[model samples]
Structure formats: C-alpha cells, structure tokens
Target: MIQLKHVLVLVFLCVFSGISQSTNGYELWMPYSNIEDSSLTKKYRDYSKSIYFPGSTETLMIAKNELHTGLRKMLGLASIPTNSNRLENTMIIGTKENLNSDIQQSLSKAYVEIGNEGFIIKTVSIKSKTVLVVTANTDIGILYGVYRLLNLMQQHKNLHNINAVDTPKIKLRMLNHWDNLDRTVERGYAGFSLWNWQKLPEFIDQRYIDYARANASVGINAVSLTNVNANALILTPMYLEKVEALARVFRPYGIKIYLTARFSAPIEIGNLETADPLDPKVQQWWVHKADEIYKLIPDFGGFLVKANSEGQPGPQNYGRNHVDGANMLAKALLPHKGNVIWRAFVYSEHDADDRAKQAYSEFVPYDGKFMENVLVQTKNGAIDFQPREPFHPMFGAMPKTPLMMEFQITQEYLGFSTHLVFLPKLFEEVLDADTFRKEENSTVAKVIDGSLHNQKLTGMAGVANIGTDLNWTGHPFAQANWYGFGRLAWDPYLSSETIADEWLRMTFSNDESFLEPMTRMLIKSRETVVNYMNPLGLHHIFDTGHHYGPGPWVSELSRPEWNPTYYHKADSQGIGFDRTPSGSNATEQYAKPLQELWNDPQTIPEEYLLWFHHLPWDYKLKNGATLWDGIALKYQQGVDEVAGMITTWSIMKPFVSKEQHEEVTMLLEIQLKEAKWWRDACLLYFQTFSKKDVPDGVSKPLYSLEYYKSLKFPFAPGIRPQWD
Candidate 1:
C-alpha cells in the first residue's frame, strides 16, 4: 500500500509541474516578477518603506492596492501604513485636494502645469525628511501616477530624486472593441470576446477587472464595448443593466464606457415609423434614450457611429446628410457632455472615380457644419487599412472641423494576429507625414491633436485587439501594438523606437542581449509585411470579406470599389491605379505642394509611386532597377527579413522564459511560411502584367500561377458571423 501511494504522489507532482511550466502570458507587461538583482531590490524596498495614502473612494483604494501589489511582488515588501501626519521617507500618493497642506504647498507649481487628467511624481524634502510624492488634480490622475511609478520600478529604473510631470496631449484616448453581444469578436484573432454577456450583471468575471487594470495602466480613458456594426437590442433594458455593470467595474480605473449607436434604433427598438434625423418622433426617441442611458451610468462616454457606409443605415437613407445624422444625436448628448464620433470612412457604389477621393469629397465641403460635440474620425489611410498607403488627405483638409485619428490595432488586413506585425511603426509613419497645409512643420499629428487648427475637442481611437486568449493578444509581440497605440494616443510625438524599448523592458527583460535584437526585429516587422504583401503604395488587394490573405485577382463583387481589381488597375500595358491629374485627379485633394509633388511620377516618393501615377513595366526606379525588377526584389527581401527575424529570436532562448521562447519560435516559423506564400502569390499575379523575368536576387516561386490562385481558406478565424 505504501509503494502504491508513493507512485501516485509522484504522478500527481509531475502533472502539477507540467501545468506550471506553460506560461499563458496572462500577466502581460505587468508580470511583476521578483527582482533578481539584489542591489536594485534593496533600493526599491528603501523607497517604498511606508505609505501615506488617505482616501475612502474606490479609485483611491485601487491606486493604493496597485502600489502595494506591485511593490510586494517586485521587492518582496508591502508598504507599512503611517499613523502620524508628519512625512518621512514614506511614499505619498493622493489628489492635490486630498493631500495634506505641507505636501500641497511643495507640489503647487507642478500641479499648476498638469491639467485634470495629468499627474506629477517627484522627490521632495518635507520637514527635513525626504519623501516621494505623487499628486494630481483628481483621483484618476493619482491612479495614473501610481501606474507610472510601478512601471518605472518594473523597468528596474531608479526612483530616487525622480521628477516627472505628464499630461495627455489629446482630450480623449479610446479603445473601440468590435465585440458582438453573443461574445463573437469581429476581426478579433485572440479568442472569444472578454465580455460574457450571458453571465454579466450577475456573475462578473475577474477578466473584466484585469481588463480595466491593463487599460488604466496604459492611460486609455474610454472603451466602446460593442461592434461598430451596431445592433438595436443592446439599447434595450435587458442589455443596459449588463453595460452598467461593466461601467461600474471600469469606473474606478478611469475608463468610461461608450456604445455604438445603431442608426435605426428608433425604428427597431422604439417602434417608430421612420428613423429620420428630421423626424420629430425620431428626435424625441434619441433624447429619451440618452436620458435613460445616463440614469444607469452617469459618466457614459458617448456614441461611435458608422453611418451610410458598408450598407449601414444613416440620414442618407432619409434624404439627409451626415451633419444632420450626427447633430441630432449630438443635441441629445449635449446635456450630458457626451460627444459623437462620426466615422469618415465613407464610399458610395455610384462614385466609380477613385475610391480614395470619396471620403474627402463628401466631408471636406461641410467642414464647419458639424456641431461642437461631434468629431469626424478618419482612418490613418483613405483606402482601408492596407499594409502601406499615404496619409489620408482629410487630415489637413478639414481645418474647420475637429478630425480625430482612427488607427486599427488589430491585424485584420495584415495577417490576423498569426503573423507578428508591430503596428506602431505604421502609425508613426502616418502621424509624422507632413501635410504642408499651414506651414512646413504641419504634420498629420498636429492636425489631429488640435494644435494646427486650435480646435478645442481632440481625440484618437484605436480598434482594440483584446480578447479571451490567455495572452491578451494572440502573438506575444502583438501586445506591443496595443501598448504602442495607447502611448501614441497619449503623446503623438513619441518615436516608435522609444515605445519599443519601454515595452521590451517591461514585458520581457531588461537584459541588453534580449532588448537589442528584439527591438530591431519589432521596428522592422511592419515594413517587412508591407514589402511582402503590398509594396510600392499598393492598397486593398486582400481577399474579399474575411481579408485573411492575398487575392489581387478577385473582381467578382457587385460594387466596383469592393473588388481588388478596382484598386490595382493592372493590365498588359502597366500596373497601379492612375490617381494623377490625367486619371482621377485624386492628388488634387491634398494641399498645394503635395498635389504638385504627387502629380508627377518623378517627384513622388518611390513608396507612393504606383499609388498616384501608373507607369510602364520598364520604368527605372530610384535604385536604378526597373520597376518590375524592384517589385520582384521587394517581395524576396520581405521573405528574407522574416527568416532573419526567426534567426534573431532563436538565440534569445536564454533571456526569455521557456514557454514564451517556444511560443514565439513556433509563431515566427508560421510567419516565415506566410511571408513566402504572400510573395509567391502576389508576384505570380503581377508577373502576368509585367511580362518580365524574375530579378537576379529574387527566388522563383515553386508553384504555378494557377496553383497559387487555387488556394482557399474557408475556415479562417475572425470572420464576421452572418446573422439571420
């Protein structure tokens, strides 16, 4: 009996060990691993000797708990509470009003600069004793400061004599989750939606709390908890209670909940005759609905509307315009200080001219017509989220209107989370592009941040990539995209390199060996995707509907703009859409210098060469290679880069955890395979037009053109669920 019991105990121990060995990546960048360096751990313990935080509110308690949790995990010492009012070397944290008089006087200058949402952390001498103080104008600010302090500790940076005052450049930074009511996430590759609507408002999952914590740490202020393809049922009483419960959970973390407002909700939910913005009954219904939502959740953010686009209902259905649809809702939300985010990603089937010019033509004419509370959210590129495209002309064109930036954090068009593509590089390129609207330094970032036009309300929205996956993002490196989006939304001027370094240190390790190579790989990952999939200003050539892989030959869609053949006007003579003055004149939408620069093929940047001006197959590129040769070489270069990334990660086994290292290694192998697949498929299709041989350095595809085109993906993940 004793021998049998020993054998069973050994088997149980083996199973337990196996479970612990698998790192699920749930902790994200806030792993809070114990500090291995004895010297740094001792220093952190010394700084966090005692806590002087004083507040009974949930937000304050959250701040206190986070500081304690992070400190204990990192330094193995919980902060002792201080009984006396006099300050020593204890860490002090609270709002400016809640802090004691002596602490307030010392931080008055810092407080004057930071606005309501900004925070300040500094070391000060109080009563001849050194104390570190984190003070802000509000409890949310205090919470932000706490996260900042903890992040610094996680990076193993010294906290002594620290003085930092930070404020968000934009007024609102939000994450738009494309999650459906049934827990299905559109374009979400991680797993099912984090929201369990079936069990919500009663059985709140711990995931919701962790979600709030992660967003709070990154300074994301708002979350739209539904798909932009809005449904009317979410507005009904059955769902409002569930949304309210989520709001209650996220409120303490400074995250306000917003919902996508279905344009026909009046007809669907209120049983009205028509959903017209001009109809008095429709207007009254919206006012009552807004009032009802506010009663349940007083701090509700607002509505995100996708109107008259992609067959969604809008004021256009009722012989009205976008301003009419947006203003009607704005008036109802005006009393609650809520704003309406009307998307500018519109294109009509009738407009057979360049689809790229449709949004600017529709919105620019009515620049100043929008209400004060309405913001026009424009995508980074005019044409869908292609791997590469020029900045949207709408950025600087709508000077009188407040245009917010909409960046897709999910890899819908790029590779759907299976391929590791760092999107911040793509975002930074768009933000840093010069618009030349007002002056030389007039960048797209300046336009969206309200500095160029001196606009009051400014905001940035990222379509979130979070889900129920053990790792918040499917790929380990994909989390950096979410982190990068928040950091850029907070400060548009920050470089991608800076963000990558910060994330690498916090998420993986501070070891220079791991940080150096991984940072290089991340910085170049997006461009590698662009090179393989759509080099030289190519746009929207993905497969129809799901957009999983390449389909440059697809042209069967009913609408002209819906087909890949419409965007890439490839023929026997040459390739690319001619958007120049001789063609569609889409360059005229940009400001003066850009219009002149893009009209001529010689003056346009090589990256945007084919986008504006279609040229002959034998045209010479800037690198002295023929256009066909350059295109082929770019495809090969992309595949080579992926191979290099795999090799780079292979040597990083010593620095990363075994589970993380193995997961990334397998993902990188998948990425390399997909990269080759993209290169072979696109080159074969375009080769028919060029009628040229593959370049010297380019590797010839193993499969025939027919073989490449015959590939199908009927069971790809993240496809939009068709509802009856």
Candidate 2:
C-alpha cells in the first residue's frame, strides 16, 4: 500500500499540473484564484480560521471537505477546522437537527422559511459570542449552503455579516442527457458520453464527483443518465448495478438519478408479445421493472420517456393515445414516489398539415386526464429547437396539466459548440413571454412554477450540453450556457445579465474592464447567431441529416416535414410559411389575444415577422427597408457582430491567460467564418426566387450559389450514430 506521504505527493503533483495549465478550464469556474486585494483576503481568512463544521455524515463530510479545499486554495489557509466547545469567532455549519437545542429553538422561524431544500447563512450572537451559523433543515441543504458560501467568495463578495436564504422555485431542476449506450451522444458537440459502460460497476471516475459538484453548486437536483431516445437494455439487471453505483456517488450532492425508459421495453427486453398499455403482461412488466430499479436505487427520480417522436417507438405505435401510454407508467412508479416526464414532441403521418400543430392538436383535448405524477414535457418552441422561436402555444392552454419546460442547452441550431452563444437570454425570453391565458401578466414562468394554475409538481429540463470534454462543454464560453441554465432553473426570474456577471467573475476575473464588455457580448451572442443563421423569424432551414449549415433549397427529401423548403415555401410570390387563418391556421391554437396579434403582419413582432406570414419582395419593414433589403441587412449585421466579437476578445488578452485568450480567439475566428457562410449561403439561395441583386451594405458572395450548394460535410460531429 502507498504510504500517507506518498499519497500527499501524488495529490500535490496532480493538483499542480491542473494549476499550471490554469487556462485549460479543467477546473471550470472553481479554480479558486487567490485574492489579490489584501483587505478582502484578510477579512475572508479571519472569518474562516475557526470553522466548527461538525457531523461525519456523508453529505456533512463532503461539505467540510469542500470548505477546506476552498479556503486553502482561495486564501492559503491550510488549517481550517477548530474543534472546540466555544462558539466565539467560529463558523458553525450543520443541519438544524445537529445544532444545539437552544440554538435550534431560537432558529425555528428561519427553518420554516427554508422548507426541505433551502438553506440559511446568518451571523448572530450566541451566548454573547459572535458566530456565523450555516444551518438547514436537512443534510442536503447544508451541502447546498456550503457550496453557496464558497461561491460567494469566488464571486469576490465580502462575507461580513452575511445573511442569505435561498430556496429553489422549480421543484425538479433536471438535465435530460441525450447520451446513448454506445457512448455516441446525439447532438453532443463537446465529446463522447461521460458514462464509460465498459468499466462501470466498480471503477468510478473522478469526473463523476466533479460533475456532481458543479451541479450542486448551482442547485441542480436531478439528471437523466441515458438518452431520451432510450435503449431498452438499460432496464436489465446488469445495467441497474452500474446505475446504483452512480446513484451512490450523486446522493451526497443532493442529486437523484433518473433514467430514460424506452416505450417498447416490454417487447424488447421482456420477451413479451406486445407493448400495448392495456395488456396486463406489458403493464406488469413495467411495474416489476420499476420495483427492480427501486430495490437497487431507492432514491431513483424516475423515467423520462420520448413517445412517438422522430421514428422512436411509443404508445402511438399501438392504437393508444399519449394519455393511455403515460398513465400506465405513472401508475407503476406511483408507489415509489417517482415521476413520468412524457414528451410532447410528437408528429403524425398526416404530414400535409403543419408539423408544429400536431402535438398541440393531439394532446390538448385530453387536458387534466394524466395522473398526478405525470408531467407533460414540452420544448420551448412548437417546432424543433430553433435559433429564436416563439413560445409554444401549448403553455397556459392546458391549465390543469403540469407542463414542464424543456429548453435545449446544447447549441443544436445555434451553431453547435463552435459558437459562443449564451442561451440564458433565450430561456429568459420564453419564460417572460405573455401567454394571455386568463388575464394580464400570465407569464410562462408563472405557469411552470405552479403560481399560475397552482400546480403541485413543477420542473424545467435542459437538453444537456455536457460531455467528456476537458471543460465539460466544448467551448469555454459554452460552459456559461450550462451554468446559466442551472441558475435559471433554480429561479425563473433571474436576469441573464446578472448570471453573466457572476459566471464571468467566477470563470475568469472580477475586473470591471473584462466584465462589462464581456457581459454585453455574452448576452448579445444569441441574437447574433440568430441573425446570421435564421434571421427574421426563419426556422429549421438547416441542411439535411447533420444540420451543420444552410439548406434552404432542399426540397427533394421523402418526407415533407423533413425538408427545409417545406417550412420556408420561398418562391417568386413570397417567402415564409403563412401560419395565419389564410394558410395553416396555426396561430389560432394560441389564446384569443395572441391569435389576434399574430394574424396580421403589421401587428406581429417584427423579429417573428416571417414566422407567421409571407410577403412580396417589395414589402416594406418598419425600418423603412424593402423585405429583400431587410433580410440582406440582417444577415450582414450578424456577420459584423462576429467580427466585433473577435475584436473584443483580442483586447481581453491582458485579463485572461494567453492560452485562454488564444483558444477563444481561435473559436471566434471559426464563428466569424461560419457567420459569413450562413449569410452568403442563405442570401444566395433565397435570391434565386427574389431574382434580385445582393443589397448594398451586404458583402458580395465569395462563391457562386452552385459552389455554396456543392459544399458537403459527411463527417460533422453530433450526428446520431447509425445502427445496422
């Protein structure tokens, strides 16, 4: 066995290696850089000298360890614990149950405010002695409190007389991993899957623990381990043992493990004849499966199901509807206190009508029919995840159902992980959208948080951007999107700008010179991608299969809904699919006021102009430019914004490490190239129908339209793995 001294040397070498290449981002906003300000350092170190963090429970142990690590790295304070009976000048951290009886009695009122998961940190006089108390109702809450305490210091906030109480607004803050069993993640641009199935059960990776720390830092309570396009083999006993190992690792961080259940598992794995919900054998198989999983992992969250979407099998494969399919699984997991997140991303064989309207038309009639444990998971937009989409009409319409918001954290349509697109601004936009369901200010945020219709179960799931990349997310700035998603999931009302500021301070530096322009660029990055890729309400114009770049002229595909030309319908007459009464009548699915507002082109928001109506090339925009000229200018503007980003990052070299600055500088160059590619490719294709010259301010296409069309990428990352 290795001696204790040998262990110390090995650990020091590993940490030093990570520290030496600090700009590699392996630490991910937790580098714990030393305080440059002497006053702040002294103040932080003075309070942290005598930490009375008691209790040896797993969660409490991790909290103590994190406190030690943070203090040592941030303030060079190696000796953190002061095991003493006295409370004066000590920072006491524990669950309310473990605290002194007198102190617990005095803090009963504060405990009531924290509920089960919330925590409180207060500096108060105990027996005429000053002590800082960090207490919560449960051990998990204490762990969360400990992370919050460290994060405050990381953000360069002075911790004098700090009194803070926080509780998550959304009950189930979750990540829906699109990872597969074979380690090929669908739409995963960072790297392959994190779960090493070949070496699981006994060999737990340190990345698992670090992943939990990052999630707990921002209060993410749940994660679905497998892909939504799930595999039935995961339900087998061999896989449950591996899953149990992961659950044990995550339990200390207050996270529960969730799995994605394939809809046809009964037939696929159970040797059953059918997977019909009404079949007794199929229902019994699911019940037994849930019981088996629960026995292995008692605190398993539940299953996320993708039924009847994208050629994936579902209850619709039988004659049954979504309600029939979801209720069956919900009943099975009800005894275990687990949930069933039924996806509302479905389409039918009737591809002639609008694909965006199929899900709403199919499920809206069965409102309030689902079991209490069942939540209808809907994506942010009606169509697939686009650069900028209007809030799905399904929200607020199903008043009695618990609708969980599903936002894609992965930059699937926003230029993958290559572009630095901050997604919290996109999430905030959808949350703040007015649904006009009952009265004024019936925002989508209120609907999901249970305040609007008073729902009992609420959740927000982000399609994870995580992978095995060194920084977790592919781009260093892409990590902000993941961080922002968690923060927004914790509190739907948080401003994207505030999230940007905190992320910047923690990830890089606290200097205002770096923070101000960086924050501005981060917030505007989403719109910049939107302008270059799919400007003015255009959606789903990406190329076939890989969806890497533009394919607005793609009309030869077998399925109408699969082709970009189906949505745009560009011709000599006009462009854009008219969703108003004159065409597909898709706008009528929304509430009365939104229906009235979106029907007319003039009354609609200009950003979503082409989403609802088509117009002639000569049509004038509110900016006093022709429709053709406006489209050309918007595309040009997007390319210019990317150039500006490159310039902004060029000057940021002084603030960040050379490696850090150069990495982003290189990515910015790639982003600028792609932005120009999007602009040129789209304008050239659309120009075919408009029969017009490139507008004045827009740059001339470097290649002919045929050359742009000829470009092909057979090996783009993030494509779904093809199976025999």
**Top lDDT hit:** 2
Candidate 1 TM-score versus the reference: 0.96
Off by over 4 Å in 2: 1-21, 100-106, 127-130, 721-724
Residue-level lDDT tens digits of model 1 in 29-138: 78776677889987777667777788878998998888888887777565455544535546777788767787788778888888888999988877766778888999
Q: What is the TM-score of each candidate against the true structure?
A: 0.96, 0.96
Report how far residue 497 has shifted in candidate 2, in Å: 0.4
Superposition-based RMSD of candidate 1 using all C-alpha atoms, in angstroms: 3.1
Q: Give each model's whole-structure lDDT.
A: 0.88, 0.89
Model 1: which residue pairs collide? Answer: none
Clashing pairs in 2: none
